[model samples]
Target: MELTVGPNQFFWPAEKWSAFYRDLAEAPVDRVVLGELVCSKRLPFYQDCIPEALAALTEAGKEAVLTSLALVTLNRERKLTADLAAMGVTVEVNDLTALAHLPKGLGFHVGPLVNVYNEGTLAWLASLGAKRICLPPEMPLASVETLARAGAGLGVAIEVWGHGRLPLAISGRCYHARLHKRTKDNCQFACEDDPDGLEVRTLDGQPFMAMNGVQTLSDSYACADYQIEALAAVGVAALRLSPQSQGFFRLCQSYRERLNGTSPAGTIASEVLRRLPGTRLSDGFLTGPSGVSWSAAPAIP
Candidate 1:
């Protein structure tokens, strides 16, 4: 399976954002989806850098895609969604509303945020010119296999969430602003402080989830290390890796090595813990009774 880098879910400064994509041009990933996916408010900070980043990735032979906002609410947001097509790249529709804005017969891609739970939904999307789809992280292996088989027959590539923190939900309310005792409108870019998102804890102090503006993410990164073979065997087309602030270039290389048969299962998870101490890894959503369960033995503490 090939590797695909999903859009950055956290907010970062314009220079840092440009640098990340510049570095990605050399990474082993085959496709890169970039744009503001979480909050529209965060777009202005780094919007200008998109063209240069897209050019760099395109020049490096990577399939570059622009993503529609996950939650499009206002009239201006609708206008923004409508304008994505003008960028001259494939638009990955995270919100179905974005689909309505696209010109008829224009080919596009579908992101994980769109609910594509069954064959009918998959077929309909394909009919609507969806050339590829990255399945939601919470989907089980059985469902993925089914979708992969369906996608193959329909001529649509299927991708799975191979790595990064699981995106649990997106809300209209900004959690970061709420934490700072500020309303969403009046709040100064609070989510910008945590480049990788602020980790939320339980009352007992256990890492529970992460807060990035209106998005809620799992505290543990979802590593598909153990299930790579199983997914590939089922005809999966690609693995989507979400962007992280630390060691991401190395992370892409590690997954590339694994896919190239030079690295073994569990190596990715181990390397992740080594690079970011105390980082939990999970594959339970792909195989499990719980979303946070890890498959590898002697789980990293």
Candidate 2:
């Protein structure tokens, strides 16, 4: 399956952001989705550097797609989505609100954050010019296989969340603000401190969730190392790798190697465990009762 790096989910510095794309240009990946998918306010900080990063990735013969904001409420955000059409790049719609602003008959992409559950929704979106779809991470394998089959008939490529922390929910409340006892409007940028996201634990200190400014993710990264064949067997077009602050480009290369059968699944899992330190991997969404279960043994290759 092809690999497409999702937009960075954290508030990393501009130089780090640019450097990640620079590294990705040389990485063995087919596509890259770049742009801020979280809070719209964070865009202005590094907006100037996106064009150079886009150019670099294109020059490397990689297909780059721009991502619209996951939550768009303000006029500025609406304008941002509208202006994306003029960027002359493929736009990945993270929110349905963006479709309202898109110019007529322009093809767009559907990001994983958008709700594309049933065949009806999928068909409707394909009619609206969605050439590709990254199904929501929360979807079960049965739903995924069904969607993948239907998508193929519609001439739409279907992708799935292959790895990374599960983005469970997005909220209007800025948790970083609540943690520091500040309101959303006047709060300082507290989320910048946690590059991966601030870990939230239960009362007993068991890690449960991760909190970004307005996004909530699972503490453990969702991995599909063992289920690659299962997904690929059912016609999944690609796998999306969400960008983390550390060792992300290496992470992409590892997956690429594993997909090509040049490396083992355990090798990729071990590579992640080596770098992240005690970070658990889950494929429950694709194989278990829920989106948090792990397999005890590797699936047969």
Candidate 3:
């Protein structure tokens, strides 16, 4: 299976964002999805750098796609979506509204943020000219297997969330702004402070989730260390690695090696721990009882 790099979920400095894509151009990834997905306010800061990044990735022999916003509420956001196709690159639809804006018969991709729960939804998107789809992180292995089979029969490539923190939900309210006692409109770009997002703790002080602008993510990073073999065997097309603040380039290499069978399963998790010490790794949503559970053992037969 090929390795696809998902769009960056965190709000990094414009320079940092440019540098990340510059380095990623040579990384061992097959596809790179760029553009703003969480908040539209973050776009202008790095908008000028997108063309350069796309050119670099394309020149480096990678399929680069522009992603649509996860939630298109404002008029400006809708206008942005409408103009995405004119960029002359594939557009990954995170919101259904983006479909209406896309020119008919223009091939597009479906992002994980959209609810693609069953074969019916999958078929519908396929009929609408969706070329590929990155399944949501919360899907169970059974559901993934079924969808992969369906996608194959329909000639649509099926991808899974392979690495990085799981994006659980997105909302209109900016949680980061609320934490800083500001309204969403006048939030002052509070999310830029936490590049990987701010961890949310429960009443008992346990890290439960992460807050990033208007997006809520899982505190534990979702590592598909053990599911790689099973997913490949099931004819899954690709594995998506979401961008993080640190050690991401190396992490991409590790996943690439593991996918090519030059490295073993769970080895990526080891590198992740070395780079991000104390980070909780979980693949529970793939098979375990809950989203936060991690199985040290191999895939269950």
Clashes of each: 0, 0, 0
Candidate 1 per-residue C-alpha lDDT over 1-301 given as tens digits, one digit per residue, 9 for 90 to 100 = 8999999999999999999999999999999999999999989999999999999999999999999999999998999999999988999999999989888999999999999999999999999999999999999999999999999999999999999988889999999999999999977999989988899999999889998999999999999999999999998999999999999999999999999999989889889988789888889988877899999745556
TM-score rank, highest first? 1, 3, 2
> Model 3: which ten-residue window has the lowest total lDDT?
291-300
Cα lDDT for residue 42, candidate 1: 89
Question: Per-residue CA lDDT of candidate 2, range 6-33, in tens?
Answer: 8889998889888889999999999999
Instruction: Sort the candidates on lDDT, descending order.
Output: 1, 3, 2
TM-score of each: 0.98, 0.97, 0.97
Better of 2 and 3 by TM-score: 3
TM-score for model 3?
A: 0.97
Model 1 / residue 77 / CA error / Å: 0.6
Residue 183 lDDT (model 3): 97
